[model samples]
Target: MDDIGEYIAKESIRYAELIVSKLFSAADILETYPRRGTIVPQFMDESIRQLMVDNYRIVYQLAAGDKVNILTVHHGKRLISNTRHFKKKK
Candidate 1:
């Protein structure tokens, strides 16, 4: 198995922090390593994964070569709506 790594965007970290309120320690996030896209896509490399932590949907993507990247974290209902802006940037 490849060694998976984490790459959290600054904004995503901020958003996650706000919702989870430091409840997710560095170790917690690290423990989620090798996280795959269970909902939106299969495996982290194919697409982003939205993990539910209470009312929040933690959006993240995994890159090739075993790397986990966090996109954003928001309320589940607003996830799809809020992600529209990111598309425009691409």
Candidate 2:
């Protein structure tokens, strides 16, 4: 029982670290290769695209002056109800 508890704790910490690292890497990729992600067909917008990092989706858009505007970052399991307005982030 003790060994099982220790393993669970370690796994939890590792998973958390993985998520943080993945998020950082995704941000870096977006900065370096803004148009690397494919367009999200559901929206039917060429400027909008999504990059999948693990189970999360990094949604962004090509703003004026060829700048990549990060819209939102959320888990894939959740539904994106309103894609119209998202708080812009650099």
Candidate 3:
């Protein structure tokens, strides 16, 4: 998330801050509405969902006890590959 903000800051600090703030706000909403986001098509798992904020995709996992774990924040156009944080359900 900070990486994105820094990248955007190269152009304008205000724009970067605004984008980061919006990203945080969108993620916070999931605390109250765990299933507020749609299923991530790439994973096909109900627990894993994504929220679109500005041009970024905030990917997260719905854990036990209503906990939402943010997995990553990346450009919308980028593809999410398998990593230590997650494996695509096949």
Candidate 4:
């Protein structure tokens, strides 16, 4: 949880200064619980949409060791395409 927070904090100041600061108060909360349920899932295995800051969608997956794998952060307008390969920068 600490690692996830740290990574997000460093990744974008906009996300940190504007979003996360007012949101996700502590990563420990996530650790204390098992798994939080999600909504708007088109498929059972592909992905799930979590509401945050009223507009953000946090796309994540759970691993074997209770690890929360954050895959992507996207806005409401452009829904995440249901695809396995997200294009990477060259």
Candidate 5:
């Protein structure tokens, strides 16, 4: 939005709010269906899955005791493999 200039600052804020609201709604679904999300194509790990919300990918890991840890929320246009959140530990 910064690059898009201040003309649409209000629009940007609204979009952000909408995205966040949808994220929470998706999380609520995970409470009952943890495996609802598909395995992340970047890793193919069953424990790590992702949900798509608008233009973002909601990456998450199924933790112990039925808890879902949100790993990241990244733009769909970018490459996620390079992100530290999914990097291989050295």
Candidate 6:
């Protein structure tokens, strides 16, 4: 995530900041908009869904009691199979 910020900062500092803000905003939206993302069938987990933010994909899951668990934020071009092993950092 820090790498993504650095890459975008090279283009424009404001744009980079905005991108990070949008990422957080997307997460907030998920709290109230859980079904906004579509199911990712490759994982065969219906709870897993992805929300798009520009060229990125904010992958998350719906846990028990409707809690939102953000799994990862990845580039849209990457294959879901490659990210299937991701475990959220503590």
Query: Which pairs of residues collide in model 1?
Result: none
Each prediction's RMSD to truth: 10.2, 7.3, 2.2, 7.5, 4.3, 3.5
Question: Model 2 clash pairs?
Answer: none
Error of 6 at 52 (Å): 0.3
The candidate that achieves the highest lDDT relative to the unseen native structure: 3
Per-residue lDDT of 49 in model 3: 93
What is the C-alpha local distance difference test score of each model? 0.48, 0.71, 0.90, 0.51, 0.75, 0.80
lDDT of 5 at 90: 44
Stretch of 10 with least lDDT, candidate 1:
1-10
Query: Per TM-score, what order, best first?
Result: 3, 6, 5, 2, 4, 1
17-46: candidate 5 lDDT, tens digit per residue:
667777778878898899999998878878
Worst 10 residues of 2 by lDDT: 1-10
Best by the TM-score measure? 3
Q: Across residues 11-78, which tens digit of lDDT does each residue of candidate 2 receive?
A: 69666666767766887887777888888666767888888878777778888776787777777777
In model 5, the worst 10-residue window by lDDT is 1-10
TM-score comparison, 1 vs 6, better candidate: 6
Q: How displaced is residue 6 in candidate 6, in Å?
A: 1.5
| TM-score of each model, in listed order | 0.49, 0.72, 0.92, 0.53, 0.74, 0.81
Higher-lDDT candidate among 2 and 3? 3
Candidate numbers, best lDDT first, in rank order:
3, 6, 5, 2, 4, 1
Whole-model lDDT for model 4 versus the true structure?
Answer: 0.51
Give the runs in model 3 whose Cα sits over 4 Å from its true position: 88-90
Candidate 5: give its CA RMSD in angstroms.
4.3
Q: List the residue pairs that clash in candidate 3.
A: none
Question: On a 0 to 100 scale, what is the lDDT of residue 52 in model 6?
Answer: 89
- lDDT per residue for candidate 4 within 25-77, as digits (tens), equals 42234455425536435545533424444455555555457765555655546
Candidate 5 lDDT (Cα, 0 to 1): 0.75
What's model 1's lDDT at 5?
Answer: 12
